[model samples]
Target: MTTTRSLVVPLPDTTATCQARRRLDELVKPVGSLGRLEELAAWLCGAHGTVPPRPLDDVRVAVFAGDHGVSAAPPGAPGVSAYPRELTAAMVRVFQAGTSGVTVLAREVGARVRVLDIAVDAELDDVARDVVARKVRRGSGAIDVEDALTPGEAEQAFSVGRAVADEEVDAGADLLIPGDMGIGNSTVAAALVGASLGLPAHRVVGTGTGVDETGHAHKVAVVERALHRVEGRVADPFDRLTALGSACAAATAGFLVQAAVRSTPVVLDGVFSLAAALVARDIAPDAARWWLAGHRSTEPAQSVALTALGLEPILDLGLRLGEGSGAVQAVPVLRAARAVLADMGSLADLT
Candidate 1:
C-alpha cells in the first residue's frame, strides 16, 4: 500500500532550467565540452518556451514599410519627400516581385512573406493576394522641427498592427517576422532608440544607403537635435513612439504586443525593428521574452537596443538591409533547434 501527499513546487525559471540541463550534458567527456554551442542550445530551448522546442509548422514574415517626412529637409537633388515617396513604392514592388533577397531566402525555407503597407507613400497596384494592406499614413512629419506623428495617428498604427497579428495567429502562424521598408526610416529609428536609451543622436546614428560623409554627419546632428527637443517629455511608450517614430515602427510595436499575448515568437531585423521591439516590450514586458534578435545591423543603435533588452542575436552576418532578410536567415537556426530536441537520440538510445 502507498499513500500520496499533496505538495506543490514552483516551476524553475524557464530560461535557467533549459540551460542547466544542456550544460550538464556538455560537461561530460567526449560529447561534452564543445564550447558555447551547448550553452546556446539550452538558451534556445527557453526562448522557444520548451525544455526542448520542436519544429513549428509554418513561418511567416511581416514587413511594415513606411516613409519619413525628414526626407523632405535633406539638402539634396531629389529632395527628401521626392526620394522616400517614390522609393517606398519601388521597394514594395521589389517585395512583390519576390525578387528581394529576403523574399527569395524566405521562399527557400518555405516561409511566407506578408508585406504590410503600414505607412507607405505610394499605392500598391496588382499586389499579390497574400500581402497585408495596412496603411496608417502616407509618411511621418519631419523630426527636425515638429513631432513625427500625432498621438492619434500613432494609436491607429498600433491598432492596425495588432489586428494583423491577431488575424495571422488565427490563421495558424505560430511565429511572426516584422520588417520595414521605408526611405529615411533609419532617422526615425535613431530618434526612438536614442530616446529610449537617453543617448544623443551622434552616438546612435548610422549611415543609410551609403550616404556621403557630410550627409551622414548631418543625419547625426538631426538625431541629436530631435533628442534635445523631446527632453523632459513623457517617456510613455505610445507617446514616445508617436512623437518620434515612423509609421512602420509604431505598427511593429503593436504587432509585438499581439505576438506576446498569442505566445508567438517574433524575429526582429535591423535598428528600426529593434526599436519597435523595445517599445513593444515597454507596452508588454512578456513580449521581450517572445523576441529573437535575428541579426546585428550596420546601424549603431541596433546593438545598443539589443544590449538594453538583454537579447543575443542568432546571427551576426552584419546585415544592414532591413527587408526581413535577417529573419529569413534565422529560420534555419530555429528549425535546427527544434530538430535537436525532437530527433536527437537520448543517452539510453545511443547506448
Candidate 2:
C-alpha cells in the first residue's frame, strides 16, 4: 500500500508561459489544436504547484473480479450451464501467475497488476501474495430474481475498494487502472449502465465471452427485468451500483472516488469499468477531472458511456477484450504523452 502525505497550499498560479510561447512558435499552425491533451499539459503545470510538467511514475492496475448469481439462468446461459463462480476464481489465479494474457502485456509496459476477489464461490489458491481477497459475499443475487447486491453488500464492496486505493496510493502508485474479471460481469455491467443512462436493454447489452443470439437476447431480457426490479431511486449512484452493479463496478467506483480526492490520475477501461467511474463521478463530479479514457470497447454501450463521461478514447483497436487488456495496451500512449511534455524540445531551441 502506498500513502503520500499531502500538504495543502493556497492555490498558486503556475503558468506555463514558456511552454505556451514555444507551442505558439511551433509549425503545427495552431496554438493548441490537440484539445484535451494540450489542455491536460497546461492543467498539469498548474496542478503540479510548479512547472516543467513532472509526470506520474508509479502506475498500477487493480482488476476486481466476482461472480454473478444470475449467471445460472437456464435456457439462456446455454454455454456453461453450471455455476461460473469457480471460473472467476480460476481466472484470478491465472492472473496471479503473471503469465495471463493481461499480466504479460501489463508487465511489458511496466504496469504492476493486482487482482481483487470482491466476491466469488471458491477461495483463491495463494491468498497472501498479490491477489486481494476482500469478498463482499459469495456472489450477487440472481439479476432477474432480486437485487444484485443488498445495500450493505454494496457499501462494503465500495469500502473495500477505497481501502485498496488508499493502500495503493500509500505504496506510491501515482496512476490507477481500474478493471474487472467476473465471468458474467458483462450482464451486470449492462444492466447498471442501462438503468443509469436510461437506455433500452437491447441497446445496452452485448455478448460476453461469445454467446449465441438467443443468449444475447436473453441477456437483454434479464437486464430489463433487473431494471424494473430496481427502479424509482435513480438519484443515488451507490444505490444503483449496489442494486444493479457487480462487485467489480462497486470496487472500481471506490477507486475512482479515492483517486479524485488524492488528485491522482485514473485510466478507465470499457463500459463495465466506466460505469463504476460514472458512479464515482455522480457522487463527486470533480472526480471526473482526473479520468483518462483508455480505449473504446466493442461493447455497444461503451461509446455511449464514454461520451457520457466526456472522455475521448485513445485507442479503438476493435477491442472488446476485458481483464484490463485494452487499458494495459493504451499505457504506452499515456507514456508517450509524458514523453512529449518532458523530452520534446521547444521551438525556441529548434529555430
Best prediction by lDDT = 1
Going through the candidates in order, what is the number of backbone clashes in each? Answer: 1, 10
lDDT (0-100) at residue 299 of candidate 2?
Answer: 83
Candidate 1 lDDT? 0.74
Each candidate: what lDDT?
Answer: 0.74, 0.72
In candidate 1, what are the lDDT values of residues 208-287, reduced to their tens digit? 66576767887887777778888878388878887788778888888877776666777888888898887887776666
Clashing pairs in 1: 71-80
Give per-residue CA lDDT, model 2, range 1-351, as digits (tens): 121123121232345534543553362335565555655555455444444456666779888888888777444345311235557888878887787777988888888988888877676646644454577777787877777787566767777888888889889986788878877777787877787788888888888667777678777788888888877866687678777886667878877777766666677887778778777777667778677788988887777788888888878888776778888877776665555566666556656
lDDT accuracy of residue 18 in candidate 1: 54
Candidate 1's C-alpha runs over 4 A off are 1-51, 73-85, 125-133
Name the TM-score of candidate 2. Answer: 0.87
Candidate 2 Cα RMSD after full superposition onto the native fold (Å): 4.2
How far off is residue 73 in model 2, in Å?
3.4
